[model samples]
Target: MPNLELLAPLAAALLAAGLFAGLLAGLLGVGGGIIMVPVLYYVFGLLGVDEAVRMHMSVGTSLAAMIPTSIRSALAHRKKGAVDEVMFRRWLPGIALGVLAGVLTAAFVKGPVLMTVFAVFALLVAVYMAFGKDSWRVASELPGRLGQTIMAFLIAAVSVMMGIGGGTFTVPTLTLFGYPIHKAVGTAAAIGVLIAIPGAIGFILGGLGEPGRPWGSLGFANVVGVLALIPTTLLAAPWGVALAHRLERRWLRLAFAFFLAATGIKMALSLLGA
Candidate 1:
């Protein structure tokens, strides 16, 4: 067991991260994995976890926590009749396959490479959120079956690599294909479940018996982080959904955009040894 003095601050930090993650999920229709991954990375680093496994552990733990958070966010959106069931079902198989492929790939990739991938993707997401117009459309409707399959695979693979649920990619893709913002958000929440479950399992199996993992780890998944994050995220997610229903969300997007941009820049700087 970890000493109480050390565990106390760690728990506190995790709780804070969970709170923010839950809110982001509810408010932005994101799975909060993007936020949680970076926070976990920093927390693990502070605790002196081996750098080799830190990013993997963070990614795995974030996905584990998202299992519940995504469900809660999805249910909240469903209550408002915002989810599109047909689209979700159509994309499921491709997403799951891609997630498995991603997990296998992540097992062999180094921490810095994964970090660089995340940083670049996050910066792109930030740029879109900050400046992309809501009225933009890439098509009159969602893609045909073949196109959707390809896109779904790509989205899941990239999401797993970045340790995010699919929203950062899914929402924008849906919207660009003319999905209503609310429906896109809700559907993304549902898709998060698809990405997280297998992704978490793959990470667990991939990292089994790895060296120098943090205490309370199972494979790459940090049990401590999952336990501290899940409950708070579940409780707070509904609150964000409530707010989402009642508020203008432009400013919230801007706020999260700035946060993501800063996080991306920090990770990029770290990668460049700046």
Candidate 2:
């Protein structure tokens, strides 16, 4: 068994992270993967986990932990009529396929590569969110069937790879096409469910029996981390959902943008050895 001394501190840290993640999930339509990924990676490092398996574990654990948070967040938005049901239903097929591709890619890729992918994409989305306007119209509306499917696939793939949900990419994409930000955020929360379920499974299978895993690991997902995260996230998510509904759209956009930019830059710099 792992030392209780170490596990105790780790558990405390994860609980704190979970609370913050819950807020983001409900308020910003994320699955909390963005926050969890880096936090897990760092915690795993302290546990002396191998570099090879550390990042993958972080991603897997984040995905697994995100499931309930996403569900709760999505349901809250659904109740508010902010979710776009038609779009969400149409995107399901593409999202599942994308999750498969993304998980496969993550399984084979290096830790730094995954970090870079997450960092660069996050920066790009943050830029768009910061400067882009509500009047922006990429195609005067969301695309037709083929385009929507393709975009959905791309969004899911990127989100899974980055250990994020649809919010990091989807919200901006929808806004560019003239969808209201609230609707985009709500829809993204639902899409996160589609990505995380299969994606977590893939990570588990991929990392099963891999060397240098931490204590309480079932494949790449850490049981302690997952368990520690869930309850706090569940408790705090409703508060964020309530906040989301009351906040102005512009403020919401700015808050999300700033958070992404700071997190993305820090991750990118750390990866680059700066």
lDDT by residue (tens digit), candidate 2, 1-274:
7778987998899999999999888887777888788788889888889988888899889999988888888898999998889999999889988998999999888888888888898788778768888678877688899899999999999888877777777877888898897899899988988888888888889989999998888988988889999998888888888987787657766776797788789888988788
Per-residue lDDT of model 1, residues 136-155, tens digit only: 99898987987898889999
10 residues in a row with least lDDT, candidate 2: 247-256
Pairs that clash in candidate 2: none
Cα TM-score per model: 0.97, 0.92
Model 2 spans > 4 angstroms off: 249-259
**Clash totals for all candidate models:** 0, 0
Which candidate should be chosen as best, given TM-score against the real structure?
1
Q: Which candidate is the best by lDDT?
A: 1
- Candidate 1 RMSD to the correct structure: 1.1
